[model samples]
Target: MTVDRSMIRVKAMLIAPNEDTSAHAVTLNVPTAENPEGYHRLIGGSVEFGETHREAVRREVHEELGAAVEDLELLATIENIFHIDEVLGHEIVFLYSGRLDPLPAEAGATLTESDGSVVPVVWRSVKDDADPLPLYPTGTQDWVSAALTRQRP
Candidate 1:
C-alpha cells in the first residue's frame, strides 16, 4: 500500500499568549477575491515526517516568530475540510495553547513565510464578539471560549 501525501495534511498551530490571556497571537490574512472579508488564524505550520505535533508546534513558533513557547498544552484536534480561494483543502489540525517569550508588540508583528510571503500577526481578543476577523481551522474559538471561561471566577 502506498500513502498519498497530498491527500491530506497535518498542521501544528499555537494559541500563544503574551502576558495576558485576554488576547492570543494570530496571523492576519488580507482580503482576497474569494474571501473579501479576510480572516485570522493561529500561528503555526506543517508537521514534518518523523516529528510529533508538539515538536512541530515549537519549531514553527521559533521559526516564524523567533520566540519560544512555554506552558504548552494541547487544546484541540480538529479535522477541517474547506475551500480557500475556491480551492478545496483538508487538514488535521493540532492546536496548542502556550505563552510566548519576549512578548510581541501590542500593535502586531510581521511573519515571513518559508515561501517568502509576508503576513501580519496581531493579538486578537479571545472573545468572539471583540475580534475583527474570523478565526479559521473552524473550532478554534470554542477552545478560546472555554479557556476564557475557566480563567474567570
Candidate 2:
C-alpha cells in the first residue's frame, strides 16, 4: 500500500530585539497576494534550494530585515498539522533566534499585505503573559515565550 503525503516544508521563526537588545521581542511579517498568504511570514522563510538551515537563516535575515544577524541558533519545531483553507499541509516550522546587531527601525520594515500591499512592520515585546497579535501562528506566542526561557542547546 502507498501512502499519499505532502512533503514537509521548512519554516523559519526569526527574532530581533530592539536596538539596545533592550528586551526579548519578536515580529511577524504580513503576507501579500504575489506570495502565498501563509508564506510571507516575518523575517524568515524556507530552507530554499540547496541551502543549509544556517544559511537560510542568514539569507532570510538580510532579505527581510536588511541587516546582519549573529548567534543564530535553532529553537523549536512545533509540528502544526493543520490547513489554512482546504489545503493539506504541515508546518515543520524551524524556529531560530538571533541578534540583529543594528536592528532596523519599525518604519523601515516592509511586509507584503494580504492585498498585495507593502506594509510597515513592528516589534512586539514577548515579555510576560500578554497575548501577541493575531499575526503570529497559533501556539506560537506561548512557544516563543518558552523558547526564550529554555536553556540553549
List per-prediction Cα lDDT, in the order shown: 0.81, 0.58
Q: What would the per-residue lDDT of candidate 2 be over residues 59-91, giving only the tens digit for each residue?
A: 776765577888787777657565543456676
Candidate 2 local Cα displacement, residue 21, angstroms:
5.5
TM-score of every prediction relative to native: 0.89, 0.65
Candidate 1: the clashing residue pairs are: none
Please write out the lDDT profile of model 1 over residues 1-153, one tens digit for every residue.
Answer: 223444789999987765657888889998856568899878998899999999999998888878898888887788988777666778999988888886778885787777778889898887779866789878788787665455411
Give me the overall lDDT of model 1.
0.81
**Residue 15 lDDT in candidate 1:** 77
Superposed by TM-score, candidate 2 places the C-alpha of residue 43 at a distance from the truth, in angstroms, of 2.4
